[model samples]
Target: MKLLFIRVSLFGILLFNGFSLKAQQVKPDDKYNRREEMITMRDGIKLHTVIFSPKGQTEKLPFLILRTPYGVNEYPSPEKQGYVKDMADDGYIFVFQDIRGRYLSEGKYAMMRFSRDKSNAKAIDEASDTYDTIDWLLKNIPDNNGRAGMYGISYDGWTTIIAALDPHPALKAVSEQATPSDMFMNDDLHHNGAFRLSYAFEYAFMEEISKTDSLYQFGNYDTYDWYLKLGPLSNMNKKYIHGKLPSWNDFTIHPNYDAYWKKQALKSRLDYPRLAIQHVSGWWDQEDMVGPQDAYKALEKKDTKNQNFIVLGPWRHGGWAGGDGRSLGNIKFEEPTATYFRKEIQAKWFAWYLKDKGDGKFAEVISFQTGSNKWKNYSAWPPKDVATKNIYFHSNGKLSFDKPSAKEAKPFDSYVSDPAKPVPYRARPIEETYGPGSRWYTWLTDDQRFVDSRPDVLTWKTDTLTQDVTITGDVIAKLYAATTGSDADWVVKLIDVYPENYKKEPKMSGYQLMIADDVFRGRFRKSFSTPEAITPNKVEVYTIDLHAADHVFKKGHKIMVQVQSTWFPIIDRNPQKYVPNIFEAKESDYQPATQKVYHSAQFASSIELPVAE
Candidate 1:
């Protein structure tokens, strides 16, 4: 139920109604003065707002809100709100809501709701409905300069981090973009504990069993053979969502990470320091890249004052609000980075904290470094003058920053996985992760030579890199593996390769380019709310985080890594053996195992990386 898939371009916000000379066009008696309203929510629940305001602008302006459970009636036409026409020339009163139910809000629609009695006073969440919609827009709208700000992207970026947790002193500044602080460990329906079965069954049949939000059809356009013949995850409630999806019956009754998914993790309630955050992410954000870097490291461990910041781009998932992010699926970043972050970083970050105008100063970490395409900044995010390194894994199909020696003699690297022939996270007829020739929003920059001649995959590479390495932050992977069956699913990628008489384009030379990947679920490898099993042939280690990255590689690039075990039907088919409830296993709990992977001097698998030099 965590699918906030709004890729922006609402038909280019209903055909761009031109007005950009620092924008200001609404009068003609306030051109159809768009207001809408419902508001209310201190427990009487109403919330469905819209607002707009600008007319002859005499000053008192600053509201920006956004909240959203996805429908503010699709901008009925305040000139179809071009998704904030680049922050409408620094004057804002905008608003727009919904968040309470699915559409014209009211109440009773809880999925990731969680506020069940936080010391009850009729407690309702999404941060008290964003502090009662910023106390009814600073007491019923009208020339509002009472300061308020909020931003969104994915699930309206989780309703702008639940409206900065307990904010409203007239809320003040926030930006979440691609949010999902934790849907069971990563985002959009489990990652570390696996189970992302075709994005939790076509995003629970397009948001809870087609209650009209459409797109569930697939009688066949190869969603990899309709999720491999929709087999088991208990045939999605015994053949096509029969329980009428209460979030797929809470994903077949919470398959692990307990306390109902750790009370819907908002990353330990992001300690708001008088709010003001930025947090947007996307280093190929195929979905909440660990929710705005774990809510900016849990608000930088209670951000003492730096008002938490982070930006990370190199687009995908709300790809910086509609293109010109200058290259993605073929990787280019030659500027235009989403029109320079919507004109110099999110319109000068809400015109410097909701309009004191400009100089609010940025860069706590503003990343965007894919293959040396520039834009760096960094004062923190994994950049304490980095250097962790590691790399390793040798004997025959090398890849080494050195380690693994003890006179190497065939360490380990077998294969065989076979859950009835799996491993195809891509390349097949594939489509439909949501309509129209979908490469599911740029399959995280495809080209890993489509699973590099998969013989049950397991690559490892190196040699060719003579200079520029420059990694820059987080990417673990570790792994010391073994798996004759007892449950498995490992994945791990990290590629790069490129260079083969490479001239600017020549079809990207040899191209492998993945740059980071993950997937772990071997019985949650020791606890994602406990699951454990593999003793079959022992050897377990399995770290896997492959998350953060800034990239660079270059100078005759090479760097590869791979290692597989079924990424099929997009992760969901780990029935190697053990089953407490892999959504009620069965179908002979799938089979075939024999995985291996070591690289000894006492099992040393490796990846680490941070580097930056």
Candidate 2:
């Protein structure tokens, strides 16, 4: 019921290279005090929250609130944020709360239910909870500044955006990071309509069952091989249920994008209200690309000029927190990318919006320009002048910006796709499981060379780069083909082929880094909402758009594009036989498929690159 306030210097603060000038040290008299409290809603449902404030004073200060489904006390708290302590010392109250149904918060867990439901679903909404929490904090706590700011990453980040929807009058600003707006299209469960089985299974386990100490240790695998070790989705279900894993039943029951995920996902009815906002994300964050982009675009669409700012770093999810800010895995970026991101971007963003200091000019699009390996601000994403180019594939392994000859299109590349031993894109052993936060979903060190060696994985490479080719924005792979079976799946990977000497360092020899890669569920190729069965032997064109990325194919580096039917155990193998929904698919539905990739003029297959002007 009590809040504390600290003293700040009245002296004018100066900015150095977009970094804050606030002293990094806490004064001897200034200390941070923490306490636990439950925020009760109008309906009387209590949501647990942990409050951190400056010690010693009985005065009130501006509040910064973060509500997350990913528990508060033991949740993956940012290890580097002594900033909370520093901010608390600087007369700011920091609050961390557990969204209902997940940790200490009391209520039946209603997954993703934030907006209005005609079904009369019982759940606590972020908007109502945020407003109620702020109202109580203002009235109960002493010394008064009624302003409140919100910020967090992933689920907590999503809540920040939800808070902006029908925003509280006292809500001043929010920083949302790696949060997804539409869970169906771009989150862990589904990507371009493709089901991410491994990622989702582990995700459900970590979120639902791992509440207890014993469960946390046994039920979840933070490392990479957990998916492969868990074997299959059916196996995961069996082990979880028999073992009495927490939330195992929930994960099993929510097979389709049904009411469960839908309730958890924010509705289009949710509009952005006028509030100071800073959207944050990573270009390489494997899980949620829609978070920052959607928030920024939604705000822009809503016509709210409430000091909207976007900071897109080169790091992965939570990468800016603990990473070196330069590289992940075998990939080594230039210098101090992560350091510059936190010290200059995140720290400064909070200082500007939450503390109400610095120039108010929020950059429309502040991002790290890859390939150039420098920072550039764009007036808009995919800068207006960016030229779109399509690279066509030829039968003889020839790829060019221009169309190929009729002779080059005579026969389609044929391959036999076996579901049992599917191709792995970014797979790795337990020893190398901890990939970059941005690419944790993507199996790292998964050398495509093996897949390239297979007849099933059609391989095509552009002739050595005559000049430096840089790509910014999303990449799309459009294929025209016919399958002998009723269904199929295609995964495209963009690889930076090393100069034969790319080898594993120190221990081994050469190592090559995978630039970016994506998978598409072919049955839902035409329409994600309404899936259709493929007409056997009837030519169909599937256009799969890969996620956005910024990379430079240096002068000598080769651009290798690999197409395969399955990326196993990461993604469940699509039964070649067409089925109603993958969740209900059976082993009897599984069949070997004869897949073809047609590249002739009549059925031209090509990849689209968002070529930067």
Top model number, lDDT: 1
Compared with the true structure, model 1 gives a TM-score of 0.38
Task: Name the Cα RMSD for model 2.
Answer: 7.9
Local accuracy of candidate 2 as per-residue lDDT tens digits, 1-613? 1111121121111100111223233334435556678878767989898876666656557788888765556321222153243344356677878777767888755445547442544444777778888888888766657888887777677778888876788888888777777666666567666677655554554444433111123333333445545444556555544534444455455544566555665556446547777787776676676567766766666655646667776665656555456765545567677777666666666667666666766667787766567887877664667677988878777677877657774657888998766665454332212212323432343455655467788877777777888787777888888898998887777676655543433432223445566677777776665678899898998878676666777776677777788876557778888877665566667788899988887888888887775
**Candidate 1 backbone collisions, by pair:** none
Model 1 lDDT per residue over 1-613, tens place: 2223333322222111111112234456443356778888877988788877766778898888877654655464343344466676455778778777666787776656775576878788887888878887888877777888888887778878876877778787888888888887787887887888887777666555422244566667778777777767787667765777688788787899898777778865666556778888888777787798888887787688898888888887777776478898888878878778877887798888888886788988898888878888978887888889899988888998988978887889898998878988877777767666777767878887887777889998999999989888898989999888988888889899888878888899988878789888888887888787888888989898988898889888889898898888878888899898888888888888889999988999989999976
Clashes (backbone N, CA, C under 3 Å), per candidate, total: 0, 14
Residue 77 lDDT in candidate 1: 34
Lowest lDDT 10-residue stretch of candidate 2: 10-19
Off by over 4 Å in 2: 1-30, 56-60, 74-91, 117-123, 210-264, 304-306, 430-447, 501-512
TM-score, structure 2 vs. true: 0.84
Best by TM-score: 2
